[model samples]
Target: MALEINMNNFKEEVLEAKETVLADFWAPWCGPCRMQGPVLEKFAEANPDVKVVKINVDDNQELAMQFKIMSIPSMIVFKNGEAVNCAVGLQSKAALEELVK
Candidate 1:
């Protein structure tokens, strides 16, 4: 399961993590976000080494603004505390795997 994150732990959980982190920026009301949730879970299950997290844009507006999240279901892959890849809109399990790779 993907951990739900907030500003309080954003740095510790994502930016400072040793493993590759997949941060899913989404809101509960977004249809696409809902669709993406299970895919993320599946991805997390398949790739145990990768860190998966969910950031609610409604709750973490500052984080969203910092990441320049203009759309729902935005997926950002972080490596070595830097954003290495980003994808907007809903993504498949295969696509998520590709992004992390």
Candidate 2:
């Protein structure tokens, strides 16, 4: 399972993380978010070095606004505390893997 991230732990777990962090912005009510979860789980299992974090947009509105998230299932790949890549909407595991690279 992806690490559940929020305002409290966002800095400690994501911003300061040594490994590349993949932050999935989602909400419980979102269908696309549901679809994206399993894909992330598989990816996380395969790639142990990469950190995967799930942020509930409803609970973390400030984070969503900070990242300019306009949709659920949006993914932001953070490298060295910076957002190097981003994908919005539902994406295949293969595509998401490629996005991490």
Candidate 3:
């Protein structure tokens, strides 16, 4: 399961993680975000080496602003606390997996 990340624990969980971190920025009302949820879940199950977390833009505006997330269903792959790859809107399992790779 993807961890539900909030402003309070974003630094500790994402910034300080030893492994590659995948952050999915989304909101409850966004249709694309909802659609991406299952893909993320399966990705988390398959990749034990990666840290997957979900950030709700409505609640964590500061983090969203810092990441420059102007769109919903944004997926970012982070290595060494820096964003290496990013994609906006809905993505298939293959595409999301490839983004991390």
- The sequence of per-residue lDDT tens digits that candidate 1 reaches over residues 9-89 is 999999999999999999999999999999999999999999999999999999999999999999999999999999999
Q: How many residue pairs clash in each candidate?
A: 0, 0, 0
Model 2 segments more than 4 A misplaced:
none
Residues 1-101, model 3: lDDT tens digits: 88999988988899888999999999999998998999888888888898999999999999999999999999999888889999999988788889999
Which residue pairs collide in model 3, if any?
Answer: none
TM-score of candidate 3 versus the correct structure, residues matched by position: 0.96
The best candidate in terms of TM-score:
1
- What shift in Å separates residue 55 of candidate 3 from its native position after superposition? 0.1
Model 1's alpha-carbon lDDT is 0.97
Indicate the residue-level lDDT of 73 in model 2: 87
- What is residue 25's positional error in candidate 3, in angstroms? 0.3
- Rank all candidate structures by their lDDT, best first, as comma-separated numbers: 1, 2, 3
lDDT pick, better of 2 and 3: 2
The candidate scoring highest on lDDT is: 1
Better of 1 and 3 by lDDT: 1
Q: Which model, 1 or 3, shows the larger TM-score?
A: 1
At residue 68, what lDDT does model 3 achieve?
94
